[model samples]
Target: MRNPKKYCEIWKLQKSFPSPKGPAIVVKDFDLFLRDGEFVSLIGHSGCGKSTVLSILAGLTTKTAGSIILADKEVRGAGPDRGVVFQAPCLLPWMSAFDNVMIGVDQVFPSAPRAQRRQIAEHYLELVGLADSVHKMPAELSQGMRQRVGIARAFALSPKMLLLDEPFGMLDSLTRLELQQVLLEVWRERKITALMVTHDVDEALFLSDRIAMMTSGPGANVGDILEVPFARPRDRKAVLEHPDYYRLREHLIGFLEGQDHRKPKPVAAEEPLAISAAVLSPA
Candidate 1:
């Protein structure tokens, strides 16, 4: 879509982290822009630093080089303006689902009254189809259910941008598909700018407006940004039936397969609020 006010930008980005053997793992030049209300996916081999990029965006990790700009403003540190949903759900095992989501809302709006925070948290939980599970603790919920909480927490804050790092990777095939649909519905309803890191080609095609393909390893950089021209309210089965679907899918598959044959790379290394109190705090 056309550029708008809520867009997120990553300019000439580069990063490095301490490797087991020596200095930090080096990530070469990278750059991209996330338009307001756009859904984009970052897809690449395991060592391509996708998660590292997410960390930088989250302000949990510092970049050795480059800059992140959100809505025409340079991003210097973490704040409620951006929300992140991780792969593991990262919930507190002892806290109930409502409390878990409440934590994030709290950070973003610390001064808001308790009742307001509770309402926001519950609303997001309901949006993610987890109204009944609000009282259940993380330990009591299934993996998929736990992930729903993570999604609920992120969207509850109404941040200008949402970052998802393979949040559905741990779920079964069917559950993953269900969550995918849930996420799409939420995005359509909210129209929040979203960036997701995923290895699943089908998932990327299903969820993203554009897919950024990255190089294989060690010094991974953005290789291509392919736009998904499929019509809005996309049909999974019908899209698959379309001749272009396979072509797009194959192109992504070929890039990933080529990365699989590349030399190995070094390893890399690495929240929130209660109701109003949670959303505005440091992660």
Candidate 2:
């Protein structure tokens, strides 16, 4: 009856790193699809190539094989359509928070007037509760504040997708939760598609529409995809109270533990492993 809408698709994605010993495959046959305005999280053990997948999707790192299609266009390299925030804030030490954000807005909206760009930057900074710190440099801001600036900068670009690689991994638990709330608020308002790579199960459950569990690497792919059944805008307390929350949390933890026990496969100089259609299903 109705045609399925595909906002972003990753087909048979693969990535590898060369070494004297052999070519180590970091990601193999990673396949995923995101509908418009959906938020997904990738969770796996450390070094499972979770970040590699995000980098490939962001066009920051080239995939050795496969393709990434966004809005029906093949991703070639870093483009304005995708915005990234990494573990470290990675802000310029010399620039003020406002300036750092304005630079990105300027790049993405060059045709707009300077005044309009400034307004856009201010709007996002204010959205992230950084309006007062707009003039402060990265060194002057606390770790959490600096990360907020990074978030503001990314959002100001108005990208079609937001790629977060453990953006809150470096913060304290309290700060991490606070930033999560800020991110949730913005995401609810903008409804931008997002893919986050995180090791935090609670964070993933709290923020994602679906969680993609990656298998262990030298060649990792999505081993399972679990939908988050909680309704949003999600309240932390309420989500914890939901029966499915703990069930899903336990399931994810169990999956990670299982991966820990599996013997890692040796690196091979051949094509990486391919993900099966069944494993990629969002059900």
Candidate 3:
């Protein structure tokens, strides 16, 4: 958050699980370049290994091949610098929302006294619209509220990078939209480098600076990267009305259709995607 300049580089990343025939590759040659404070979403059909790639970056899964570097350091096992938010809130049922967030703040700020750490937790919890629910236990909160805590905890870390795997996938649509707005508001404060894995096209278009589309698995990889032209302080209504919004949406759907084994592969667009974002931005 201080520098507002963090970089994540993934090169030739691959993950494979042993199979009777041979190694079953889920992700292969997955190269991604994330700029400082940029939000990038990885979207593909379910089971396409988008989460696999994100997990690798989060240091939760071992890569069968390739290298991952963040802040100029190679990613090994899980580290505090990277915060992960999954579909589930993953909170401690016994702890209050505030305590759930405080546990992380305490670990990251061990030198700080309880009062200071409590302040950190309170600030983020309030930011996520959980100010009144800070003292409530996980079971006492709704699913959406629990996720709010997850988001709060992640940002409380002030992590160099954030890895989110379908953080909103399990929520109801209304709750999802509310949390998305909360996420945008909080993220705008620091713009910490973030990578999210989701299949929701509207969700990606509304929130991301760029969208990374993945091919079908086995051996899924980034097939294209679309540069979003909508200006920041994004309004959902304005983004939906943007001239290029549907075009970009169609492009994403087209890519997915092409990768769908159930149908014939889609022919490439007549316009070369490399021309500019007006056409498309291939990765």
Candidate 4:
């Protein structure tokens, strides 16, 4: 791995892309200071450029302006150092859970022996509590199970930074919480630097060392970086009961709600299926 301290030394990064209907997302004068192993979650309305930021970080999309530095190297194109997990699990339906993870290892470490690749995948699956389901196909798994496969795949590569675009966004409430626990376990164990984009205030509070709240659309910029001071091993019950929980949640909600004089679009009787589905499912 490259030197993480050198990665932290640069400042004032920016990115944007042209859209026929104006830029889909624009980040201006953005200054993000990230440490070696910290977890940061980005939160904003749907179109506030959360995923776009992840794309820029992953080197999957080009930045119209500014720059991105990972470890000590400037990101030129998609590199093995950053692993991205999308909102959808995006598993190969034909592949088993274990194979899905092994595929990542194959791509990132093609020279590793087949047995070594299997060992790495199995380790991550066991870490995520999916060892029993290793051989199950995507079709046989629940939404959360599919995402657990995704998580195992991403972590198995041992990426320097894990970029998560609401990886649990499609799971039900119970499944979401269950995966959150699994994620915490993997995150703590690996000490991987992570950046996650999410809409859920509670979920952000649960997983992040800091929550980077963005402004409303068009010219969205980061508004606040709220630090989560609660110590780990953080327990779900204890975190909920922490006196600071409500305060921190309300602060994030207030920023997101107050941005652009917009209220969260109410769940009408007939929204688009994908949008509707995402709202009900937390990830």
Candidate number achieving the greatest TM-score relative to the actual structure: 2
Q: Please report, as a residue range, the 10-residue window in candidate 4 with the lowest summed lDDT.
A: 274-283
lDDT of candidate 2 at residue 201, scale 0 to 100: 98
lDDT of 3: 0.86
When 1 and 4 are scored with TM-score, the better candidate is 1
Q: Clashing residue pairs in candidate 4, if any?
A: 168-283, 169-283
Give residue 232's lDDT in candidate 4 (0 to 100).
Answer: 91
Q: Write the per-residue lDDT of candidate 4 for residues 1-283, one digit (tens) a residue.
A: 7565444322444454555644433555455767888888989988876777788788887766666777776777787678788799999998899988887899988998888888999999999988799999999998888898899888998998899998888889999999999999988888888889999999999998889887654444566789999899789999999999999998988887777475444332232233323322222
lDDT of 1 by residue, 88-148 (tens): 9999888899999888899988999999999999988998999888899899899998999
Query: What is the Cα-based TM-score of model 1?
Result: 0.87
TM-score of each: 0.87, 0.94, 0.90, 0.86
Give candidate 4's whole-model lDDT: 0.79
lDDT to native, each model = 0.81, 0.88, 0.86, 0.79
How much lDDT does candidate 2 score? 0.88
Model 3 alpha-carbon drift over 4 Å, by segment: 1-6, 262-283
Q: Please, what are the lDDT tens digits per residue for candidate 3 over residues 33-148? A: 89988999999999888999998888889999999989888899998789889889999999999999998998899999889899999999999999999999999999999999
Candidate that would win on lDDT? 2
lDDT of 2 by residue, 80-121 (tens): 789898899999999999999988998999999999999999
